[model samples]
Target: MVQRLLLAGMLSGLIVALFAFSYARVYAEPNIERAIALEEGGDHHHEEAEQGTVSRDTQRNAGLLTGLVAYCAALGGLLAIGLAFLHGRLSVRPRSAVWTLTVAGYVSLVLVPQLKYPANPPGVGSAETIGTRTEMYFIMLLASAISMAVSLWISHRMARRAGAAPSIAAGLAVFTALASLLMTMMPAISETPYDFPRALLFEFRFHAALLQLVVWGGLGVLFGQAAEYMEQSGLRVEGTARRGIPNA
Candidate 1:
């Protein structure tokens, strides 16, 4: 069962990758190009010294496709494992559960952390702080994910006594408070050049967030349908086997 779910997820991911890749190629790549141009224009010496081995065209095409494929595939596998654990636990249909999980995942893993440390296009930040920025981002992501899980557990526990609506509200409140505290406690890092185009920066971040939404939303829809079909097929098989049994 786990294996089947994993396969379904990976397949769905592969299908969704096409849409993600297209979106990135169309909306995201131009911003990256402009950012690279600005960086190269500002620092010819650095650009010459650090000439990349891969061409920009390759990076925008093959590299982008490869990255999207791998990322979505891994995300799908994780989603599959999550669905297996959550199976029959959420009281909702498989599709609803998958969509809920997808939304939660985007909020916890991407939206919350991005609010703190948004995605930056190439040549935006200093090289010296790259490691620090990465570490901080991952820390924020981890905390957000943990908080979400705990809040869900809290909601589940309280639902029995407080009723569904109140339990959900309480869970949201806890998550909001925890996320706010973490964001405040973390040291802020602003490395964007003062002279950088604000419009370009905003566009890049917006497209980055949109790209993630496309991937997660697409996965939820596709995988949910697949899961429902799988469930119905299994039931039919079981019923057929029962009918074929001996009357004794």
Candidate 2:
């Protein structure tokens, strides 16, 4: 069970971490494209366009990356708390605190914005566009700072059990994100021009699907935890449990 605790804690934290990184790519790609279309110095690759200049894309993507990373970090803390419960390793107060911050952070970043503006993009230019964009940046920075601290605590808690590298988890996450992006592309469906290489057939549905479902989602604790728990229980009954188990 101790080992399980360590493994679960690490896996959960990683799931959240990957989600955070995936959010960045999601925000960057389309947001950058929109910037290229809308703003003066949006496309850096274009020589006529100024490079390294901050445009709406930078603001939007920056805040988005910040906000999502923060949320995921907090979620990692929350997952750590859940791991603690499973392991009998954390106190109620500390666990509750971590869980609270996780939910609070997520709502503040992902949900609260909905109160002022809807979560999904609403075709950019409305009266709300300027102010909404401004508000998004403010929230992103605030959330990112708070979440980073919480994530650090989570990482410290899971240092031993989270044996896998963060980079590995990130790979799974980004893979899923790429799948999601392909599945949702509008340009391909509409015969509109998209510089990105994508299609409606086998490429995404099979190749991308495999990585997303097998690699990324497969590594998540939430999905695998219950099954693993049952398996461990069965093993303990069979006298195959870890050395800590008392002989029955």
Q: After superposing candidate 2 on the true structure, give the runs of residues whose Cα lies further than 4 Å from its correct spot.
A: 1-7, 16-28, 41-73, 82-109, 119-248
Q: TM-scores of the models, in the given order?
A: 0.93, 0.34
Residue 167 in model 2: shift from native, Å? 42
Tens digit of lDDT per residue, candidate 1, span 35-98? 8888778546535745767777788899999999999988888888999999988787778878
Clashing pairs in 2: none
Give the per-residue lDDT digits (tens) of candidate 2, residues 120-190: 22222345456656655465435444544455455445545674366335433443343344334312212
In angstroms, the error of model 1 at 144 is 0.6
Report the number of the highest-lDDT candidate. Answer: 1
